[model samples]
Target: MRYLVAALLLASLPVFAQTVAKPMNDPKTDTFLRQFAETRRFMSGRPTKPRITPDEKTVLFLRAQPTSATQTLFAFDVATGETKELLTPEILLRGAEETLTVEEQARRERMRVSAKGFTGYDLSDDGQRILVSLSGKLYVFERATGKVLELKTGPGVIDPHFSPDGKQVAYVRGHDVYRLELATNTEKRVTQGGTEAKTHGLAEFVAQEEMRRYSGFWWSPEAKHLAYTESDTTGVEKLTIVDVMRPERGGNTFPYPRPGKANAVVRLGIIPIAGGKTVWVDWDAKKYPYVATVTWKKGGPLTVLVQNRTQTEQQLLSVDAATGKTRLLLTEKDDAWLNLDQDFPRWLEDGSGFLWYTERNGGPEVELRKPDGSLAQSWVKPAAGFFGLARYVDADRTLYFYGDPNPTQSYLWRVRDGGAPEKLSTGTQGPAHEQFAHVAKSGGLSVATTQTATTMPRFVVLRSDGTRVGELPSVAVEPPFAPNAQFFQVGKEGFHASVLRPRNAKPGVKLPVVIKVYAGPTTTVVRHSMAENLLNQWMADKGFLVVKFDGRGTPLRTAAWERTVKYDFATATLDDQIAALKALAEKVPEVDLARVGIEGWSFGGYMAALAVLKRPDFFKAAVSGAPVVDWLDYDTHYTERYLGLPQEHPEAYEKSSLLTYAKDESKPMRPLLLIHGTADDNVYFFHTLKLSDALFRAGKPHDLLPLSGLTHMVPDPLVTQRQYEWVLGYFQKHL
Candidate 1:
């Protein structure tokens, strides 16, 4: 299999994108674009979402065939080092075409799942049953017998999960929660009075989109009781997204709360899965409206994380399932918006203690607490690059995690309950590459994706003794060439950045440059991974030097550096990008300042547009994709966190908005190309229209390319191929 993967990488796939993008002058770039789209940026055919069985013997994961977007479930036995097919989407659907309900489609969109087949699966606590949902239908795979059975349920089954005992499966359908008894093949409704406006066992839009809490229900340790959220989205504003290219299909209306608007009134409740009275968990909903996270473990209380509207404060409340009462266990506050750690309240099985992560002392750190929530020990000093726990081995009471010693690289580490931290991942000496570990619940087996220098991601299974068991094979096609980026730092503060020069360019000749920027919080652009620089190299191959840098607002840095962008997205970000560019130009003479352009998508799109308008003298042209014209048009949780409530801080909204600079006659706009999807629900299509309207009114020289029947993600191969061609063409023409 390894030989086959290597052979396939050396071989070539016929170009399909050229049929659509044949008009481009550079055939090499056109072929690269075609391959990039077909391979999903060379991301297809990679194993993902590996679920290690409870016994720590088998590893279950999802992978697709080479150059395919569809994925299938497979299992690997640790002892035999052999992999076998568990389930395939083709076999489930047979010859019929699969259909996704609107709710499921929206859910996948929120999760950013672009693949076609089984995107996710849930394993029973005993590891006997595997529950998966495809195209609104539910199925369970029995491990012992190797038999797959379809659970007879209503249409649009969402978030189906097996109970702790594995005898039953519970899911939300038609705004209500239902449980299916496996033995009798019977289904029972657990809740009543569910409507479109009041959804039971379904997460609200903001919670799913911003808070990263996808499921609205969780089963108890014994599987007797279930906790769920009932959300009332009555007063929230509705945004109707329509595919303008096909208007006859009508529009999709969804509850979308803007900044300062009414949010979903979500209430927590505990109800018996066997059908009984409901007990509502008591909390101050008016004060902390965001139900961030909920955790229920064997020896711990049912703790829920709640955040205030402004996200400046949050609290961890423990709820008594029987009495429906709550107690505040911990509180975290920040002068600006608080950054959350998803992995917390990790309770130990012996009921001795649990782990809690916080940033109250400046950066992220973890603390161990006793059963009563008293601090037992501070695990480590605040590490800015500390990612959440990968796993907690209950038997040994050790925690496995991924953390970065510096900004550009990350490694997997393990720390026993009372011992110091130890690095589990290797390749610590060379240029930075990402390392991730997934230790089994039983603690003897672990699967890690560890890379060094310029290698593709390889999922290697390792033993507890630090010996390799085997590698999970990947048929993912390699890029046309390795993206060997020149990694360095810029500015006096040493901001992380990378520059990619044309491979065949003359040393003395200067190259036109494109500064690709996505300097947003929670993400750092410049990394040591070769895969991270593929697009930059692709652009550089087209006779342009591509530069990318993580400015002050990017993560994996000091909290003070990220907080600088708070309430002011206009000046500080642009000034930092300019400073980084000027500093880079001082070091590399090949950086041609006379021909500089900028391009980005989403938040970066907003920045790109802001560049040409605010600093036209620096950026000659820009290609802004799916930009937010005004901060007021964005969603509530994200916008309000950075730029306060629009009602209270109107000046921040006005200053951050592209329309503000577009309307300013003193700041002249340069050549710009605006690309946006007509069906974009995140940063809606209204943004481009609004910005284009303002620019038109101001007599600005710019171009607008509207993608019909598309969303925020350009998943369609033809569409993305055309976008690359247009982006390069616009920059080449203007510069």
Candidate 2:
């Protein structure tokens, strides 16, 4: 398989046009663009939402269709080694267009899901019934009879989940949470007093965008209770996102928490499954306002993790399910700020203790705490970097997790309750470069996706004992292009970077450079995964040397390394990019730094614009997409967490904002292209427009391309393809 992958990579290289200069829209480039946009994505066959049954006999996953951006349900029988399609969008949609409600569309945007037809689904505890929401409607699929039933649950339903016992389906409609009985066909509202400004059982913008918390409610193991969040956004400022393209349709006005602004008032409560008095959890809402996480076990008390506004201190509280009384179990603190860890504060099977993760040992470590909040045992393996815990298979008395000692490689490992951790993934297959696994809780089964530096994603099903069973089929067609990146570390910081020269460039020829970057907090562009650098390869194919790196402030590093930007957001990220470029330029003499260009989206977009505006000597051109020009305009939770309140640190605000440099005469003029979606609610079209206004006032020459009706995500394939062409043409003109 490794040799086959290498053969495919060599075959995909662009055929050089030796005789004449080919048009930019040549067949090769078109094919690359198509693969980059449509061919390799939705319907091209990638498995999502993998579910392993309790019995471990079946593995269910959603597979995309080849003809459309719709997903179909597939089931893999482990015993028989057979993969079969269970349901497709054609049968579920019945040829009807998937019409998403406004609320549902926003939710999908938050979750970054652009595909249609059953984007998400929930499986019952018994794995007998599946609850699916399609086009704002609810449907249930039964495994025993292979039947589908649509429940008339009204309009605007979102975030549906089945009860632990599979007796009822609970979902959020309008602004409140509702429960529907399966047998009686009866519906009941669990909590009341939900309005446009106050919502129940739905994640707020900060929780979804910053904290990575998607759902606002969790069902108890007994199916008799539910713990839901009630968020009141009356304090946060409201912003209207207008659609200038469609004058007939008005805009959507919702709470937008800007820097130094008020955040939503959130409260947690427990209610009976059949509708009863709501028991609100009591905690110091003033001090610890942010509910970072919530977890409920079958026999344990409800657990909540809350943090203060500064995020320096976080407390784990256990709430009484009946009385709503809360007891502070433990408090974790850091001098800078506490980072949210995934799958932390997990409950043990016996319910006598729980598992928690910490970095107090100068590295990542796992701690077992008794029910009384006293620490029982703590374990930290050498070089076990801080990836999240995957699962704790009680049957095997082992816990599985993901971690990487090397920055570019990751793997799966299992450790006994009080024993040394052992690597579970195989290294012989492909070096185990980048791996992810989902270990089933009940059954001794696990599904994993393992990819190497040169290999495409390979999905395999394995037993808890590391026995390989079968592989999930990928319908995706290999792209007619391949990446050839040289990975290395540079500078005293040992910054990770990948340098890709133009594939078609002549030997010893000088090439213009393009630094593709997403040098943002908690993100790294340089990695060993094949999917991580495809776009970088395409840019290199277009005749520019492409560079990518993870500088200061990116995660997967030490807490000190990531906290470099806690008080200063712009310096480390930008300085490191420049340093990496200079270091690589010294090593690779073919790099023509005189004609360098930079491009990025969101935070990277901010970096791109910042590079040309603040350091025009290094970057000659920039393409900024939906850039957050001003830190003050960003959300309170994210911006404040890094730069503090704008009101308190006015100097830092002025220095970090790009608007401050818009008219600086000290910096020389550079060609820049500003692209933004007018319907972008996260960064807001106002950001780009305001920056453009500043540039116009300063008489700075620049180009602006505004996309209408597109949100933060550019879901249209045509637009995505055209975007690459535009950027390429702009670079050609400037460089």
Using lDDT as the measure, the top candidate is 1
Query: Please, what are the lDDT tens digits per residue for candidate 2 over residues 564-654?
Result: 8877777898999989888887778888878999999999999999999999988999989999999989998788888887877788888
The stretch of ten residues in a row with the least summed lDDT in candidate 1 is 13-22
Number of colliding residue pairs in model 1: 0
Best by TM-score: 1
TM-scores of all candidate predictions against the true structure: 0.95, 0.94
lDDT of 2 at 194: 84
List, residue by residue over 670-733, the lDDT tens digit for candidate 1: 8888788877878888887778767767777567677777788888988888778878777767
In candidate 1, which residue pairs clash?
Answer: none
| Candidate 2 ranges with C-alpha deviation above 4 Å | 1-23, 27-29, 40-43, 380-382, 426-435
Q: What value of lDDT does candidate 2 attain over all alpha carbons?
A: 0.80
- State residue 94's C-alpha deviation in candidate 1, in Å: 1.5
